[model samples]
Target: MDFTRLSSVLTVVGALMLPFAPASAATLTFEDLNSGQASYDVVPSPYKGFAFSGWFYGPDTVYAPASGSIDLFTDYADPTDPGAYVITSNNAITSAVEFVFDGAAFSGYSGVTFELWDAGNLVATSDSLPDSQGAAPYGPTFLASGYSGLVDKVVVSGVQGYFSMDDFTYHAPASNNVPEPGSLALVLFGLGIGGLSARRRR
Candidate 1:
């Protein structure tokens, strides 16, 4: 093959291999509990190629004397089971929750999984299995597609008394399948080729 043709083939092959490169793994942990200012933020667009999204809950504040606890549930509508799992004011909530990927960045994750620790015990878990209350009704819902840029805020509602948010976290996919560089690199390389061809013709 001529130098020009060989160069073209190598460039194409390199472009294709770029997409299969390993992805970076990023984890965001929410461990600060500030009164009225309790939240976690994650920019999945940066590392949208993650393979897993997880959240963990630890013990509660022993000093803060509160009446009610926080319940961990997905963003869904189900008046019947308002508080899925109760995290009392005295104990810790620890659980490895998993989420589903929809093919997009973090925007694709629409489910929330975690254990609700009530009074220091694993009271309930949010998963695909059926709950004692019967079939699982509402699931962890994400904001509308248009609102993907905004961080999806989840708050524990319907508390009998008062409580505080200690920690939260979110994980993202880290694989070549999610954000493949093949498409992006190919486009850029194609643009380069187009420009070169145009200049040669001129």
Candidate 2:
């Protein structure tokens, strides 16, 4: 049996599969929030791959961001005065990371409390971070770190007036326990060839 050849083939297959181990990222730009209808519009539940919660603003309507696009803002329609908006994804976010936004519109004192959750269970939370610290403004980006598991839900609350959310980002792993079809096929092919050669030698 040509063990060396089989080892080399398996190594190549492993290399090809390495890139898939890392999570794939997806971003919700909020550009299509209004469906190109108007500048000011109310966000709906399950818009742009995200499920929203605690949104009572029926027609209060949030205006466009500094970029003049349909973005996410605090809900004033809800009697909850200080509202905490929740956005949850349908899939699991293996790595809950930062987002992009340009905040500080009403005042520089704008702060937010970010909470990360996984399937209704709390995972991690961030201190009240200033709006202008992460991105330019009206942008992100909640910077989260030191989390053991992934999160699919995020809760964000504003300290001052309404803050804008230009975009949000999250990552989803390719597959939890499978090697993917293509990679798996290659590995089986390599083994088959080695097995055939050994059989012929017998």
Please, what's the RMSD in Å of model 1?
15.0
Worst 10 residues of 1 by lDDT: 101-110
The lDDT values for all models are 0.31, 0.49
What TM-score does candidate 2 reach? 0.53
Worst 10 residues of 2 by lDDT: 100-109
Q: Given candidate 2, what's the lDDT at residue 158?
A: 59
Model 1 pairs in collision: 49-173, 50-172, 50-173, 50-174, 51-173, 51-174, 57-93, 59-92
TM-score for model 1?
0.23
Model 2 Cα lDDT, one tens digit per residue, 1-202: 5787668767876776776676655556555554545334445655655555533222113333433445554544332343533322222222233322112222222455566676567767655555455333333344443353566666665543345544455555444566768878877787678768876887
Query: Would you estimate the TM-scores of all the predictions?
Result: 0.23, 0.53
Stretches of candidate 1 exceeding 4 Å from the true structure = 1-147, 158-167, 170-192, 195-202
lDDT of 1 by residue, 92-189 (tens): 22223322211111111122233333334444433322222434322223221121111222222222112222213343333426444677677668
Candidate 2: where are CA atoms >4 Å away? 1-20, 35-39, 54-68, 76-109, 131-142, 145-148, 178-202
